[model samples]
Target: MTAIDTPNGMAEGTLDGSMAEFFKAQTRSSAPVMVNVRTLKRFPTAGCARLEATLIQDGVPTQQGSAIPFVIRYEINLCRDGRPPTEGIDLDAASRVLPR
Candidate 1:
């Protein structure tokens, strides 16, 4: 399996600001956190890359706002990586990625 690029035109296995935000939201809490990204493919796969948020608060990350904490909102986006040019990751939708 190949690495996927961020929704934006980033190199394969890279995350943009929006992607970081999505990860934070998924984990919940505006406080900053880090994300380790790997392809949801194959068996016993290797991790692709790890992304750190630009800022952190109380061990959680806050947006790199201008002298203020930014509200964690969905207006943010997640860069999707795939072997080929795929649509993107739908965090709101569940992926049938695991065996039932």
Candidate 2:
């Protein structure tokens, strides 16, 4: 139930997106052709967790379209007990990103 959107870590990039949301406690989220993200594990002293995901430009993009997939990584800082897995991500009118 991990939530994923944009590329987590990258320098000088842009998210041509409109709006989205994610839960802090949510993990193991996925998407069919959007992007794949998930949490590996947790630690006691860790206020932040690790998420691994991939973003791909699937075909569904043009009249006669072709696209390729991309790989991205995320190191998110989430508060414990903040947002549960079944909770709804409010997006705040945007998407959840993990770029550094």
Candidate 3:
């Protein structure tokens, strides 16, 4: 099982399996409607492996239009075996997707 280490605490299991705990700990208001999960890159060091991914969430809506879902952008990092310690796992950064 994959372990999700958040600033609040840690959750152990696959993403789907840990949905309840994740929402309780990380989100506010509504639950995530969609998660566009994609890996950006991978780094393998001596003792641990590092993974970078781009996550987009479609859940909370914009103030202007409630019907249109707000797209949230996030960059996440996952560390294996906790080697470096500097680079930890979980939601690293989050921001609203700007319009074009």
**Best lDDT among the predictions, by candidate number:** 3
Query: Any runs in candidate 1 off by more than 4 Å, and if so which?
Result: 1-16, 26-28, 37-81, 84-100
TM-score per candidate: 0.20, 0.31, 0.35
> Cα-based RMSD of the predictions, in order?
12.0, 14.1, 12.3
Model 3 lDDT per residue over 1-100, tens place: 0323233222322234466446434544245434444333444442233333233333544566453443445545545564333434232441234333
Poorest 10 consecutive residues by lDDT, candidate 1: 71-80
As for TM-score, the candidate ahead, 2 or 3, is 3
Kindly report which residue pairs in candidate 2 clash with one another. 1-27, 1-28, 1-29, 2-27, 2-28, 2-29, 8-99, 20-91, 20-94, 21-91
lDDT of 2 by residue, 2-95 (tens): 2322234222322233321232112112223345555544434433344454443322232345433334455543434554332245665334
Q: What's each prediction's clash count?
A: 10, 10, 0
Candidate ordering by TM-score (highest first): 3, 2, 1
Q: Pick the candidate with the highest TM-score.
A: 3
TM-score of 1: 0.20
Q: What is the C-alpha lDDT of each candidate?
A: 0.37, 0.37, 0.39
Q: Give the clashing pairs for model 3.
A: none
Q: Candidate 1, residues 1-100: lDDT per residue as tens digits?
A: 1223443322323334886678567545455543233333322222332332233323333365334333331112223342322234463453566355
RMSD of 3: 12.3
lDDT of 1 at 45: 26
Off by over 4 Å in 3: 1-32, 46-65, 81-100
